[model samples]
Target: MITWMQRHKKWLVITIWISTIAFVGAGFVGWGSYDYGKSSGAVAVVGDRKISVEEYQREYSSLYGQYARAYGNQFNQEMAKKIGLPEAAVNLAIQKNLILSYADDLGLTVTDEDIAKELVKMPAFIKDGKFDKELYIRVLTQNGTTAVAYEKSLKRDLLLQKVESLFDINPSSNEVNNLSKLLFAQDDLSIQILDPKSIKIDYDDTILRDYWNINKIKYMSTNSYELAISKLPFVTVSPTEDELKEHYSKFKTDYKKEDGKIKSFEEAKDDMIKVLSIKATKKDALKKYLALKKDEMKFDATTVIFEDKLPFSAENINEIKTATVGDVLKPFEGTDGFSIVKLIKKIDPKPLAFAMAKDMVKADYLDIKRSEKINNIAKEAMKDFKGEHLGFVSRTSIDKIKGLNPNEAYGFLNKLFMSKEKEGRIDLGEKVVLYKINSSKLGTDTTTQEKSVKDILLRLQKEELMTSLIKNLENRYEVTSSLDNKE
Candidate 1:
């Protein structure tokens, strides 16, 4: 079922024309930011259509805001760059423009009546189960979009949907039947596993030094920081039962047992008290931070490593990284209490000398040597099995193999199913398995096979049609992007 969903998801994305505002607004944080020229609001020109800065900004903000809320301080500029959010934003805009451009070339146009009908049917634009013009206008205004612009966007989306729906790649009954047999077929296998750790490798100072010289960058020093930190302990504030109960009432749903039953106030009293105490301490911590900023309060400073030695979190470390020396960050909750942290010093990352990184280099060298040795062992094992020295076991699911870890079992099973060779030795880091298939048979359950195949065939059709349509349309239309020069 999980595999079926994974296969069908792309088809669903291609076919469904969801609510425009909601689709654009949701997960916009996944795209970073794009800059259209200040002189013109357009970011990119596709054929005759222009993608506006307003549209880009709106979608980017929505997507980034969602990530920020979910990730807290973890979603920094560096993280955004690593995820290619900016490029993703531009691609999304380009895809939209491509569809719209194709629609325009085909002379597709939506009437005001068509837009009106769609708008009225949308629950977001309706009040009292009926169309409400005032409500619609107000909602659009609140989202920083005008009714005219939104309507225009919606019309384009509908036209694009109409164009996309024209292609069909649905399979025949015979095709489904053949596909079903392939999908439901199960292979019976005989197997033996070899442990990599059983083999040993010897290492000396010379070997370690040589390894360090080649991979010195891997042994680089992380950024370090000097910080002046003061704590506002949450236990200092005593939260009364009444206050705790009030806080509990506001967030009662969160206090749930393993059985899904809501934990009573009595069951959650201790936790509530601690949380309320922390909430009160946050105010005092802020006051302390303000005084620290003004140099009215003194804090004991300590040198801390920015990466592995962090007393707070990666998110807080990133925040500190952005701050200049002498800048004080506001109070944040840590393991013990609310903390006010001031940036006292910053250290840039640098590679360690070979002498200093010898131990780590030795460990890495051993890991590489062991992996190589294991691969060689597996190859030899395969040769021996082919020579018939090793006896084969009966048929069993790859997952049901004795003594293999769950992760290794699933991974090996997936690999075995994907492999073309009937007999081979698979290397799985910790252990290697030698496998040989005796027979393969399709599933006997007709109803399950038919239903699964039908669904898979439909998904394949949708995917094939979508891919062909995109390629044909892209070539058919003139496409251009100013993504390289977003500013």
Candidate 2:
């Protein structure tokens, strides 16, 4: 069910991408002097198309909101800015306009009936297995879009599809057969999974200290917050069954299996309760924050340093840092629950002395030495194996190797397929695999081969065509941007 929904969502996104053109009318809105070429009120202009600021905001907001919801507590303005969401929004706006201009030049048109039919077909606008106009309006309004705007956008999407379809390229059956033979060909190999546990390494105190001195900054203490935190633990809350069910209904996307089916309530009840409880804690924490803001309540202050080492995230620590001494910060949610912090002090990160960081440095040194020892073992084994004649192993036949763990075997096969030298070693955590492919034999799976090649060819041709079209459109159109100017 989840996969079905995901596939549908992907199709919906693709449809939306195909239809609309973004026009940027980046001229001033009557700001300063000198009349900087009439404020067209567009963020950008491509040929005759003008992309308005409102359209850019709508697109950016839609994308931003989706990510914000997906990320939940982790999504913040800082993170959005760091990811260059604003710049991406502007760029996407420009790209949209470029394509729309090209589509217009090609004389592509999407009629009212086309948009109406598409709207009725959308599951989102449907109720009782039928198109509901009121429901459609309500859904669009709820999502900060109007029916007119959505339809107009949908029209552009249809036009894009029309334009893209003209360049469809189909590969011949023989070409597909040849490619399939190459891709599906199996290789035989001699394999061994090296055990890291079997190989031991010894490091003296002097060696550890020397390594620590060189990499001391990597071992520096986290920038922590010394604070009085009142944590509202979610485990204290007991949610009603109705509340759990409601929560499940609202956030069902989170509980979907890879195969797309949603877990039954009975299977998901415990997890649902946990999520609801955390939300409840956050709500309570907000109430506490408000009360503290108004001086109506005072939380018990037990001072502790909040750091990454103490199970709290860097995001939580950063939130704590945002507060000043005696300022009760607005509560923020963490992995455990919600925390309200009164910042007492900010602890700057400090490099630990050799004596202070001995155990940690020793552990680090040992890990490095162990990896080196294992790599050396694999290398030495490779030399010995190269001289001895070993039987070939098929790409799909790694499971036949005696005593190889399923995960290790798959990891070995992945390396085997990807290796450029036809022989290489793969470090699979606890084990290492040294494989050498001796020969390849193509399997007789014509149907599968044909389908794979067809899919690959179609995707490649579309990408190449679209790229060329976009580049040609950009050169053909007289494009200008108002996004670079101020006021």
- Candidate maximizing lDDT: 1
Tens-place lDDT digits, model 2, residues 255-365:
633222456778888777777677777888898888876778776676555376544555666666666777787777776677777777778889978888898987777
lDDT of each: 0.68, 0.66
| Weakest ten-residue segment in model 2 by summed lDDT | 24-33
Q: What is the C-alpha RMSD of each candidate to the true structure, in Å?
A: 8.8, 9.8
lDDT of model 2 at position 417:
74
- Stretches of candidate 2 above 4 Å error? 1-93, 120-145, 202-217, 227-345, 353-359, 386-411, 427-431, 471-487
Q: Estimated TM-score per prediction?
A: 0.62, 0.63
- Candidate 1 per-residue C-alpha lDDT over 1-487 given as tens digits, one digit per residue, 9 for 90 to 100: 3345335423323233223434423322212244455725677777788887766664455545545565666665555544555665566666677777777777888788887777777787678889988987776654446777777667766776676666645678878877776665677667777775666789889878888878788998888888888877776557777877788879875564433245688998876776667777787888888888899989865656646677776567778889899889988788788888888888888999888788788778887898898777667777856422223221225446766887888778778777899898777876878888877776554556687679778766776766676678678767777776543
Give the backbone clash total of model 2.
Answer: 25
The residue pairs in collision within model 1 are 28-63, 29-63, 29-64, 32-85
